[model samples]
Target: MKVKSFKYLLTSISVLILVYHLINMFIFWPEIPERIAIHFTKGEPDNWGLKYFLLVIPLIGLFLWWLIGLLTKHPEKLNYINLTEKNREKQYTMAKEIMILMQNLLFIISIFANESLLRYAAGMENGVFIFLSLFLLAVILISLFFNLIWAATLKE
Candidate 1:
């Protein structure tokens, strides 16, 4: 996909996920206990805190979305080991694409985490959350590696 179109798609998905999270928070708020799971070990709650702490995930997601959007607009400011006059534009485009992908994946992760927290608070298991987390992490790492290699090895 073209960078512009891909960026727009990511933005739309992020916004939708954010809105969904907000709605879920509102719907689930009444059912959440005074104290909820804030941390997990072996898929079990290990740390507990006030339900309000759940807001942190969505807030972090918003901040990251904005920061990544800013970075996407100015990829030239990003550090690069292979930057040169011949490859600058291509590298910048690649960087922007990578930033956009990362932002989307991270936003999804944040939403999943928030949902997992809610589920845990309701005494539910999060096996799917754990699996999705691992899968997304692999995707992010693999995409980063290949995209960097492609940019670094660019000709003309």
Candidate 2:
């Protein structure tokens, strides 16, 4: 897909995720526990906070989308890991792809966390917790691995 289309897809998905959280927060506010799990350690919920703290997920997602848009709008502002006169264009393309992928991944992780916390608050089983955690780690690791390899292949 074209970069512009991919950017739009990311933005669209982010907005949809935010809307889902907001709607669910409002509809289920009364059902959520007084204190909800806000942090986890070793795959277990640890830190706790008021249920309303769930808003942080959508807020952070919004911030990530904005940051991604800013970066995509001005790729020149980003630092390159292997920038060179001959490889600059290819390197910048890779950087932009990384930014886009990161933006999407971060938003997805935030959404998963929000859903997991909401489930816990409602006294429901945390079914997605492990999957979400693993997915987030995998995306970051794979993105880094591929991007670095791609950068290495660029003409110097």
Candidate 3:
């Protein structure tokens, strides 16, 4: 797919994921315990809070989605170590792509975290939550690493 189209696709998917998370939370709200597990360590719940605290997850996700979208609108404001007149446009495009990719991955992570929290609240163990979280984090870091490298090496 073309670059612009790909970016839009990612943005669309991110929006969809956020919506799904919010709806899921709403649908399952009644089932959550009065005091739910809000934090986890090593796949185990460590911190607990009122079930209403669960709203924070999707709210944060929504805020981040909006913030990232706004930030990408002014790519000129993005910092680039090797930005120059000749390569300025190319670098800006790369920076925006990186931001979009990060946003998408973050949304996915947020959904997973929400699911993990809900499961914990229900007194269930999701053994794979930690592993999946780590894997997604690694993917984000690696993608950023390579995208930055590519942006740095861009020619006029």
Candidate 4:
């Protein structure tokens, strides 16, 4: 696939994962909704702190994408986005990798955290967990290849 199309697909996948995570937080992690209300003095570890941190990965990935669009304008059929510098490409690629890694971690967690997601659908027993884990694992594997590809392509 072309770089642009691949990036679009990745963006879509990342967004979906992020949304799923957010919804999971609401459904399973009671600590999530009580975040701001949670008192540090209560001595409770931040509720679902890792999930919150995981959520930041995709947000940062989006920010990097938006930055690349704003800074570089090289696509032949460029829309409102632009990416003129090589560093921007590298940065975006790095952010994408980080996002994928974060997602894979969350996917694994969801498999075990039944309250976060119903693993069993139709009595299949956490079918979504099984499927999502596989999907996220595939994404992570592909991302490793892309990481090498981007590194090679961006070489001066």
Candidate 5:
């Protein structure tokens, strides 16, 4: 399969954004390592500015999955010469498999983001990081678990 045209486009955008953010975090950034100043300044916010820089991949993954779901579930009813319910169902099954995989990966990323690796976003506040991390973790886990279990609900 050609992987669908719209999916290719969305995947390309996702790769681009992911690269940009990774470069911004690892190469172009000037954050003070371990709260230690290596220059004339005291220090930075421990990479506060770049904590959430590389989160675009998950967003793009979501859009691509949605596009795949729509295309597979709603192929042109008259375009195929021998369109059958079996073929349509097969396409929908493939799309659901792919979408669930995407959802699982996204949820895993969210779980990692809830760790200290990207905890500087909310600053050094006492409960800001903990609160937001737990909230996001819960949301991603719940969404992925439920959506995967209820993939049939997406049939149209």
Candidate 6:
């Protein structure tokens, strides 16, 4: 996908997730406890806060969406592997792909985090954090593999 399209898609997804979260929060407002689990470590809640603090995920998502959109527009400003006149185009494409994937990953992670917070607030297990971590690891590995391929191709 084009960088602009990819950025817009990521932004749209983030906004949709935020809307879903807000609606879910309102739906479950009555059941939300006075104190909610806001932070976790080793799969255990370690910090507490007002239930309204649950909005933090969407807020972070919005900030990240904006940042990604801006960065994607200027891939030349990003650090690139094998950046040379001959490979600049290829490098920029690679960077755009990487940024797009990262943006999508961020959106996914935010959604999972928001859901985890809600589940924890409702006294349910927040096992998805581990799952999300694994997904992130996979994304990083895949990104590295693609970077290697692009770098090797650039040398040709």
| Model 5 lDDT tens row, 59-110 | 5545655654565455453233233565565545444444444544443343
Off by over 4 Å in 2: 41-45
Estimated TM-score per prediction? 0.90, 0.84, 0.84, 0.33, 0.34, 0.80
Question: In model 6, which range of ten residues has the least summed lDDT?
Answer: 124-133
Show where candidate 4 strays beyond 4 Å: 1-89, 104-124
Evaluated at residue 41, the lDDT of candidate 1 is: 81
Model 2 per-residue lDDT tens digits across residues 3-81: 8788788778867876776787787789977888888888677898987688877687768867886897788898777
Every candidate's lDDT: 0.83, 0.78, 0.77, 0.46, 0.45, 0.75
Which parts of model 1 have CA positions greater than 4 angstroms off? none
Rank ordering of all candidates by lDDT, starting from the highest: 1, 2, 3, 6, 4, 5
lDDT score at residue 108, model 6, on the 0-100 scale: 67
lDDT of 6: 0.75
Query: What are the clashing pairs of model 5?
Result: none
- Scanning candidate 3 in windows of ten residues, the lowest lDDT window is 122-131
Ranking by TM-score: 1, 3, 2, 6, 5, 4
- Model 3: residues with Cα > 4 Å off, grouped in runs: 128-130
lDDT of 6 by residue, 1-156 (tens): 576787677667757766776787788778889898787787677998988777777778767866886787789888766678987887888777777777767766776787778877876676766487468758867896978776766772
| Candidate achieving the largest lDDT | 1
Q: List the residue pairs that clash in candidate 4.
A: 69-82, 72-82, 72-83, 72-84, 73-83, 119-126, 119-127, 120-126
lDDT of 3 at 24: 68
Which segments of model 6 are wrong by more than 4 Å? 1-15, 125-130
User: What's model 5's lDDT at 84?
Assistant: 52
Q: Find the 10 residues in a row with the least total lDDT in model 5.
A: 32-41
Given candidate 2, what's the lDDT at residue 43?
Answer: 62
* Cα misplacement distance, residue 145 of candidate 3 (Å): 1.1
lDDT accuracy of residue 109 in candidate 5: 40
Instruction: Write the number of the candidate with greater lDDT, choosing between 4 and 5.
Output: 4
Per-residue accuracy of model 4 over 1-156 as CA lDDT, tens digit each: 344565566557656766775576455544333233211233333433333443444455456555545433342332212344655654555654444354434434343333222212112244455465667667667876776566556533
